[model samples]
Target: MAVELQKKGNFYMGEAPGMMEMGISNKNLDDDGRAKRTGTLITASAHIITAVIGSGVLSLAWAIAQLGWVAGPSVLIAFSGITYFTSTLLADCYRSPDPVTGKRNYTYMDVVRAHLGGIKIQLCGLAQYVNLVGITIGYTITASISMAAVKRSNCFHTHGHHTKCNVADYPFIIIFASIQIVLSQIPNFHKLSWLSILAAVMSFAYSSIGLGLSVAKVAEGSGDVRTSLTGVLVGVDVTGTEKVWKTFQAIGDIAFAYAYSTVLIEIQDTLKSSPPENKVMKKASFIGVSTTTLFYVLCGCVGYAAFGNNAPGNFLTGFGFYEPFWLIDFANVCIAIHLIGAYQVFCQPVYGFVEKWCNHRWPENGFISTEYAINIPAYGAYNINFFRVVWRTVYVIVTAVVAMIFPFFNDFLGLLGAASFWPLTVYFPIEMYIAQAKIPRFSFTWTWLKILSWACLVVSIVAAAGSVQGLATDVKAYKPFKTQGHE
Candidate 1:
């Protein structure tokens, strides 16, 4: 009469008498019966850094330039604070009834389901997946821009800076798509720690280079840095309507820069359960956000100082720093490398969602479920799924083509930020926290949270409108795949 016990979420349940005879041991499995999670603070931080410090960082200088001296830094800091707060709230939602021992919510959608459990889940999924897809597209455009910048930098050095270095972005877009097609085959988030680490390093590398060059430009008294209290004067710099749209777009760009909540739970799912995933995630968020905010302030402010009212949408690729041609080329190379890894970080969830749905929908089909073990001499035995290869390749190709069609980087980033910032980053987390914590109706805390959420909603709406206007303007003059140089 031996009693067999199996651990569930926080309780152990009695199994059938002969369960142990099946030779299954709980020692190597977690409560949910998956392989033990081995993630630590470092790995989780790497993932956050990889996701947060992405192509969005490149547009901050332009964003700052649009908002001017006071509003630029102020908005950046406010976004950082809000992101960190919402992140902490989202972290606690990683588990259910209790923060530490409750059932695990694997994805952001899972969290919404557990707490809200309605059409909200579908809304969350839509916001999240669409944002992820948008980010991948944005990254593609950015990577190609960086690639083109490298060639342009070398060209500028050879032929003068005044020479028209009209390098087409289509070829570079294809090259970036080719690189992503290979990297997208990385099975899951658990296997991306090393890649995340490398990408984080590249992010820091290019960010530092951008910062250094901006500082150099300022110190040398290089250009006419015409900064005003309010950014881009109405008539002198831009029309009144243009100023308003640029300002709103700037807000969206900053919003996009702080966006990582969509992937926070995914990152938390990788953590080892000892120190508690929520605690570890909070610390990681603090570290990641703090580090990136410091970089953002430096890059945005110094870049503004360097180029003033003429700050480029992309700090490095915008030809603002042309003298140090070699340095600029190196920075662009780092940007391309960093984005290569970042593309996977954002898109892995999308890949997982599609694969999971396919497997569930057609469980018995070998085409979707089968993984082939193909031996590669140098790389050891690898499991290759024909479906994954085809699907992911097609996905990358589609994104590449779309990027070529509309490669307006700043406007695109702003639109993505505006679209996802409120729903995915702010509203969902606050709602989940309020529901889980059981805050009383009309209570002080509840009221404040509602106000905060609504305020962000307003921000999102304005940002989206601004971005749409910018896109309309760009499209009127844009020639799809024929876009070249800094048009």
Candidate 2:
């Protein structure tokens, strides 16, 4: 074939037989040099919700405790807007013109490598995996706690007294991780849409149940000295740097609650794209963030209203005082189910990256003998080889081991948020949007937006610093193999 040359972004491509689309199509595309787009707005919405809400929702009450009432809602709303805008920015950059294929770019790392390039892409990968593994660990810890709580609740309700029921974190972590190992074998993102939908529904169910329980506690006067809206700021120790430090911690939690940008591009790739517009992805981002924000506000505000400064980091942990044990147990079960599905959803990109690397490094492997052909009516055929069986099991084992080592719920949340939030969620999106859009930094309209982005970065840095300090302190006080909130 005759060769043609073209430039897209910072790279040049030559159009010839097996030349232009060499690296881009390595793992993502099949024989036709195209990736399957099989997601609709609904499925995309489910994935977004599944990514955005998890154990983080359970940490919002503790966030409220840190930031007080006025600041709590304010930070939540601010982070919501920031996340939605950044997510849409990510969607916009998902595709770029190709010399031969017309357009390409399927993963978040793809977008980063295209725009930022060099060591920046490596940095993005590091931040991404850190965030992903951190999220999985958090989910594992939360699932174990929820399952253990169910065991304890059953014991209390059935046996009538607090007997020695040793339902610790390790066994439940192993159980949930094993379940995740099976779920992670699903091979592709589009197939996980149904699972994501179920996860999203589960998130809403438990959130509603928790909100209802909080309201009931307040209404029945059984809650511990409930307070009004003003009570959020009242008695808060804003004296000296204590208030500043607490506010930073609150920022970290809020940022962590909204830290779904790590997987936004992968989710966008699942959308059906004839002309490859991001309109559907944008809509999905909006709907998912809006839905989660509503739940975060309801859960955080109500929990704070009920417990005030006494609210534990895990909202369910506060149920130690509430009545009607069945409701709490039911809600915990919902949380566990949601986390199981969320675990698979979030881990898909990581799984893909590792598999792609393996395929690249060892293109021919003797161990891969079995292949299952998957047929999608809209997107044609794909293959599932045996390597999935090996890698996903290992991934689950690593996560389970980590979860057992440090099951401190709120402390890990702070650490992960602080470490990855700014780099992955705030910095990359803003810089890439500015580069792709070519927004003039000197102009009045662009100046303030850039400043706002910088302000977000500054806040994230402060929060990350605070979280690091907090995590170190918690590590020193940590008791290995001990379940959080049990002792």
Candidate 3:
């Protein structure tokens, strides 16, 4: 009797398994069987910038205020390095073999579920949804504030600051959310490349304008310049518990400022794997980080020098929307445009998660398949469906409502950073890398990395606590829902 059996390791009867294998998926191809490769190095870099830089940059001066000159820039640089390292780890984990086929995990949850397990997947999904939704709310708040600032500036020339300025965030939130609702229909992250570039340019525009204004203020001796080795310590500082709490809060803020890791895998999925996948991603990461770091350092130090401890959470607010008013208006416009795009970029993953669940639960419902591609001019072909409209609209509405209710712009930033930044940015990447790299638990490198991970956990805990304290304090001190009609 002749018995034939397939070898355990052999994926094929006699052919050796190659290093990489192709599999069909929505991400891998368009409708016409053409391989989908959308983002280039430039566009990838643009996505990175649009993802990394947001309302968080506006909070850097306030972050510097928390840590003072000595620790402020130091923490920003350190987090940048840390985030870059973790992001590379995520990039590495993007591709993995599934017994006979290789697959690219498109979302953060996919990575966790693949390496970790279902429990971690659920937790990651929770953290990511909260992080993304909370972040959108924060952006909404910031956009409204920017609009309000411009309006106030425009109005102040006619009606003074003292003249009962009741122009609230409600109107601006509705208008901006309307724009976002329309833009959210783009369907794919890679398709938003031009928008990402536009957002990046806008980010630079506002940042440059802010930096130039700040430098002019300092040069002319028109603004306060407080520079010292220990500027924060020198003053009558918040001693005891409050000081320690604020320090933790500052770490959280810095973490939030550097966090694009949560969406790194999704963004990497947008790039073509032709130029070696990790290489393209790393280059894009380096470009985006370097540019944003430069902006953060300049804006933080200059804004700090100009306003010292008095620097508002948004440095633009510190500028008070005064002369060169056109620049301020333009900067705010840039911010508004950038946030609209940023909202879509970040929310794409969230939508995917929801849609995936819905499709699995109600596979027979025929909610319009997203499997095939429709060709578009600039963004190539994309899979658009009716579900995109319904789900994303609901998502936008929810975020808009939260923004209207909380409207605690800066406070919410600290809260989100503290709560989500560690798990998504620090903890997940380090753990996943150790698992993927097969690093021994007690090995010298593993021991050190584990220690660093633990340290991050501690920081995250303290930061969360401190952020909660700060939020509560703000709530008691200041009223939420600034709009009277909303209340």
Candidate 1, overall lDDT?
Answer: 0.87
Per-model TM-score on C-alpha atoms: 0.94, 0.85, 0.86
lDDT of 2 by residue, 454-478 (tens): 8877887888777766667678887
Question: Ten residues in a row with the worst lDDT in model 3?
Answer: 10-19
Q: For candidate 3, what is the total of clashing residue pairs?
A: 0
Quick one: RMSD of model 2?
6.8
lDDT of each: 0.87, 0.74, 0.73
Which window of ten consecutive residues has the lowest lDDT sum in model 1?
Answer: 8-17
What lDDT score goes with residue 290 in model 3? 89
Give lDDT for model 2. 0.74
What does candidate 3's lDDT look like per residue over 1-487, in tens digits? Answer: 2222211221111111121233446566532233466778898888889988887888787778778878889988988887787777777777663311246676788888777875888888888888988788888888888787777656655676455445677889999888888888775665688898898888888888888887877776754445555445433545667667777777777777777777888887777767656678888899999889999899888877776765666777434336677777788888888888788778877776776666556554545333334577796654455666777888888889988877766667778887777789878888787877788879998998888888878877887787888778666766554532110
For all the candidates, what are their Cα RMSDs to the real structure?
A: 5.4, 6.8, 8.1
> Which residue pairs overlap in candidate 1's backbone?
none
